[model samples]
Target: MSEITPELVRHLGELARIRLDDDEVTRLTGQLDAIVDNIAKVSQVATPDVVATSHPIPLENVFRPDTVGEVLTTAQALQNAPDAAGDRFRVTAILGEEQ
Candidate 1:
């Protein structure tokens, strides 16, 4: 069994900026030591020949075929103009002069 003392628990709580009652610190210390021992047991396993895998399955791209359709005329493109002053589109006053 791992040794868990009240002084160790108080020190750990102070380091973490936590204020714990004596009873709570005593209980938490035992639990934390148990958890650490269990993790240490897990760390004792050997992995000499195992290859690391980042993801489970492979991926493939799914795409749709290209399409060609009818195009709009230039006159139809500039039909819904709020204010057009020339053969092209027009706008309001400019804030700064062109460079």
Candidate 2:
């Protein structure tokens, strides 16, 4: 198993844009070292024949049926706008429209 030293911890902290204190660096070093050892064990047993899968269980698409509903009235739609154009809702001029 490869050891995670203080140097490694400092490098990781730099990469992650994190400023770790002495206690945090020491704690993370031990945790990262253990993770590396466990991953090494898993890698050693994983062979070329083994296929990578995104999910463990079967995924089926369950989609809802398309349906229509009643539309809102002009009065309801214009109620939220700060400045409305009569019965219709008015908005600020779009940036790129031509005369």
Candidate 3:
């Protein structure tokens, strides 16, 4: 039998700052117990000879190799800027502090 009890559920609820009434506590106790039992069953079947996998079937990378492509020059980048200061774009200070 799973070790999940009503007291443990109530304690978890308190730790998470959640207020669980008696009805909710009772309901969650059974649900949590079932989940724990299922996990236990999986653990029993997960032997050293068994291989663990995220997916049942093998997956291959279907993406292109990461390589540098065309990039905009500084002048090309700042061409559409409404305001420019030196070689950078300028906007009004948001924090009301002088630069």
Candidate 4:
């Protein structure tokens, strides 16, 4: 089992800019020790032949094919615009630019 000493916790607290009281340090020591021990057990079970994976289940792309279909004409597209220019939608100038 990995030993989480008070000195180690204090050093970590300084690096993280945290001020841990004596009680907090003592509590974290036990919690951190358990976490390290669990990780060590997992490492032992992971052999060279076993493949590493980020997820337990397999994943595949579920997207539809990208194909052109019927499209609206320029007049049809601009029919519902509040303001329309010659062949496009018109809007008030932004960024104070001249027409």
- Candidate whose lDDT is highest: 3
Question: Whole-model lDDT, candidate 3?
Answer: 0.93
Error of 4 at 53 (Å): 1.9
After TM-score superposition, the amount by which residue 60's alpha carbon in candidate 1 deviates from its true location, in angstroms, is 9.5
Clash tally, candidates in order = 0, 0, 0, 0
* lDDT-superior candidate, 1 or 3: 3
Off by over 4 Å in 2: 15-17, 82-99
RMSD from true fold, candidate 4: 6.6
Write model 3 residue lDDT over 1-98, tens digit each, in one string: 56999999999999999999999999999999999999999999999999778999889979989999999998998999999988899988888788
| Predictions in order: lDDT | 0.78, 0.87, 0.93, 0.91
TM-score of each: 0.46, 0.66, 0.61, 0.57
Point out the worst 10-residue segment of candidate 3 by lDDT: 90-99
Model 3 spans with C-alpha error above 4 angstroms: 63-99
Highest TM-score: give the candidate number: 2
Looking at model 2, residue 39 earns an lDDT score of: 89
Indicate whether candidate 1 or candidate 4 has the larger lDDT. Answer: 4
The sequence of per-residue lDDT tens digits that candidate 4 reaches over residues 21-80 is 999999998888888888888999999999989989989879999999999999999999
Pull out the clashing pairs in model 3.
Answer: none
Ranking by lDDT: 3, 4, 2, 1
